[model samples]
Target: MADETDEPDSAAHPFTRLTPDLVMDATESVGFQCDARILELNSYENRVYQIGIEDDEPVIGKFYRPERWTESQILEEHTYTQLLADSDISAVPPLIIDGSTLHEFDGYRFSLSPRRGGRAPAVDDLNTLEVLGSHIGRIHAVAGDGGFTYRPLFGLQEFGLDARDAVVAAGYIPAELMPAFDSLYDGILADLAALFERVSVNTLRLHGDCHMGNVLWRDDLPHFVDFDDARSGPAIQDLWMMLSGEREQQQNQMMHILRGYRQFNHFNLAELQLIEGMRALRMIHHVAWIARRWDDPAFPRAFPFFDSERFWSEHLLSLKEQWARLSEPAIEIYD
Candidate 1:
């Protein structure tokens, strides 16, 4: 329930222009009757809402952040989700109106989807973890059939160096912490690059941000939502985020996940080596994501810990620890 207008310079926050009236008009523009009841969902990168329609089930309306993605990239995501649905995968595809999934209203691009609800999956449950793994495996099977020509690739230059640059450029690090931040960040990237050179894995279209939050569970089944982050990346990029706990516990979890994974598609165990590297990239990218969106009112509210000397100090320490983990042997799964 944070105010979308909390940013001092409102003009810098594009979402501030997206008033409720505009939302209602946008829904009606697409031939859906609005009941004037809209609940803003939990999202900062883009504005999302559950809008009620007269005489119909409420629909989820997602307004894409302007200039963030090209039309081709958005359509590619829609096509991918539709393909998943066609294959009987539990994914929600954008609703097609007037022979198109993407729609424009008042200069903003948006998509509508039927409202689907479920609680977050219990990833710690071995059975649930395997099921989730199988679902991702099936999604990957379809993804590997082809490549995304327009989507960006997940690599050190994009997720690591560029991310670090964004933070520095934004002037987020306090003067006192700049040296520590720069030194630690440079070292982390160097270690990550060395690790990447040691192994090569196939990159495919992926759920991209396949964390537990993006998955919804119902009736003991898992359905994925939010492919906004979908891109070309290693299969392990989709797998590493679900793991937690001590190294031994994570190893056990990976075994169960791969057990379900291999049933659908051949998983390259070599990709296991990329786990910690991918983790480091995500850590860097997350800070960059926040830094880039700091002008948005929601970001400052949600990530109050950012832009502080203490936060950067701890972040440096975390990267150092991760660098050590990168040198250790990758997790192994056996029959």
Candidate 2:
């Protein structure tokens, strides 16, 4: 595992500040006996623990990465919770501690919230897709109406994944792996500029990172998590996230979301068909992110291409596919 503490403020994003032993002791101090083991859940910048009590319900304990210096994850959670509630969108509620607020443990900030109920659905799962679409509709409604209003905090990376850092992250790959990473990374950057010029939607509070894996299907209910990547700007910015893992056949996921989203939202006629181009740009971002998080536990795994030739050829194929649809397009009509 690459050092999760490799960022600038190494002390802040400590992986073990709130250890399982510490959690057991804390709960015990509060008169609850945590009987079950604390299992580790993956996250790129934070630590999540699945804690189960004998007679009570299972819960999740989240330790915000100490390295979260730029953005206030806690404040973002606090605000997004209330905003989602006002929008009637259910989300992970912030845990309260000592009647004040949930934050780093003493000097150590951490929080405990309800664990997601069931299994994480595959990207193309229909039911989960509907859940994602509906919830996103609600979010768009809120954001478009000026309901979700707050600025995000940034570390060194201006956004959760900086466009320029895309290249720097490629440095992680060994020299032997250099050519392959370069070919994929360069194509993605080009795709970024192309998509930025093509798509349009309301500049609302987007989920920022919206791929299928970011959600869970618990007892048939779909739940979304992780706001560390949140940012402002074009709503279609989320198109990248929604299509992140659906590379094999992203159309199904895109269409499934369109089916549900169109019910509550409207785009200029041209904007609707541009979904393909928008999603193509999203794929580029996803691929670059995959390269960046090569050692990141929470991000997607590496592409399965055999070599640089295959990867570049794949990018060319996707570019051609995207351009084919770009000719007759949906232009953005912002609110």
Candidate 3:
């Protein structure tokens, strides 16, 4: 008999039903015999685990968050990854069982993938950045094929405006800092909108959350993972997150990345202007994401600093910094 406390309160979280037994049962239902070893992976938006197989190597299981994305959207992501694999890109794709990449078990949607291992890419290394850039360029070449019919688009409304509204509605802003935050946030959004208007960039399907954490480096090569945030957006959306440091350092880094990026796909110099705008949107959207997921038990444990007066104060100050950068010229790369 399971202890009452051992059972998650479904009313509080959708994952309450995802007990260990349920995880094993779901894997077995999909025809994979479990060795009863389940190691939870580091994932917040979805429930991911490394489940041991009866007589084989371990496999990764990812259970989608209920209602976060429709079936079509998830499948589109799976299909996109499959396409990338077909192109010989080192991308991990979901295992197809019964001709479907997605499966349903006990009302939860999930997928299994072979476990891939590697350390985080060296973002500070120019050579590594260039290699990552080439990988992204190849990805964009495939993405430029057409727009996603079911997936969402990345823009101010989705990343900025909607995020700001959600944060305000959630009342996460500290009472004392609300006034300053409101003014700074609004000004940032307005400037971001104006910056977007000044640039003419085409939107293509992108590896929506391309950060060092998502890319694994092995043998000096990069393998992209987690296309869950995949959507249509500016190419710069995938490029900006890889950069760090002073303006000059970022510019030098951009030159290296573009050198490799231009090999497979056309490098749009004009999109360079949207880098800061994209960065600002990500900043706002990230906070809103944390706020929206605050109810999840894992969130509080992982992000104990969030919602504190100090956190919000620092966050507001960072917003001010981003606001200032938004007014400055976009990063320029020279030969």
Candidate 4:
């Protein structure tokens, strides 16, 4: 048996019933025989496992968080990824069984996918980024075929305004830091609203969270995974997170990425203005996400610094910096 402290409480968490036997049974229920070995993967919002199959390669089992997404919404994600795979874009989609990609066992909705192996794409290499950019542009080209019927849009209302409200309402900020937090957050939100209004761009289904962790590189190319965060948003939402380092470095990075991006789809120069605005929105949303998930045992273990005076102090400092960045001109991307 696993140590009590090391595992999330079954009663406190939905995964209480998710045992090794249950996982094997779930995988076998679809047809394959399990080898009875289950390896828990690192995932917070949902439980994931790599289960060995009898006489076959291992498969990935992803159990969805209860009530987080409706059946149709999950299907939308599956459909999009499957479309990408069929279109020859390097993406992983769930395996289809009995004409369905999604299946449920023991009251938990789950999906199985053949595991693809790769390391993180070299984000700083201009050549590698150019390759990844072309793939993303192709992904977006397919995404533009239609809008999501269920997934939400990435924008100010949810990521910015609601996030700011949730933070203040949670009372996580130190009493001494409340004024600074509020004042800085308010200024950021106001500027965010103005920036969104100033720069109007078309929206398309996006990878949503295109960070390095979600990408795997093999054969000198990129393979995208975890479209769980897929939603409708400006193209920059997909491009911005891949950038790192100082302003000049990010500018060069964007230039290379766009070089590949523009080949498949039109690149809007005006949307460049929203990069810092998007950053600000993400900062606010991150705090709120942590606060909302605080009740989950994994959250405290992962973010022990949360709700502390020092944490709020540093957060406030970051917000102040973001406020300044929000005021400055957006990162320039020369063609």
TM per candidate: 0.96, 0.66, 0.95, 0.94
Which candidate number has the best lDDT?
1
Q: What is the lDDT of candidate 4?
A: 0.87
lDDT of 1 by residue, 213-321 (tens): 8999998899899999999978998998889998999999999898888889878898998998999898899889998888887887898878666787888888888
Write the candidate numbers in order of decreasing TM-score: 1, 3, 4, 2
| Alpha carbon lDDT of each predicted model | 0.88, 0.55, 0.88, 0.87
Residue 175 of model 1: what lDDT? Answer: 81
**Clashing residue pairs in candidate 1, if any?**
none
User: Model 3, poorest ten-residue lDDT window?
Assistant: 1-10
Residues 104-179, model 4: lDDT tens digits? 9989999999898999998979998888889999999988844688999888999998888888776667777877
Candidate 2 is scored at a TM of 0.66
Candidate 2 accuracy as lDDT: 0.55
- Model 1 lDDT on a 0 to 1 scale: 0.88
Pairs with backbone N, CA or C atoms under 3 Å apart (clashes), candidate 3: none
**lDDT ranking from best candidate downward:** 1, 3, 4, 2
Better of 2 and 4 by lDDT: 4
Regions of candidate 1 where Cα sits further than 4 Å from its true position: 1-8
RMSD of each: 3.0, 6.4, 4.1, 3.7
| Candidate 3 vs. true structure, TM-score | 0.95
Indicate which candidate wins on TM-score. 1
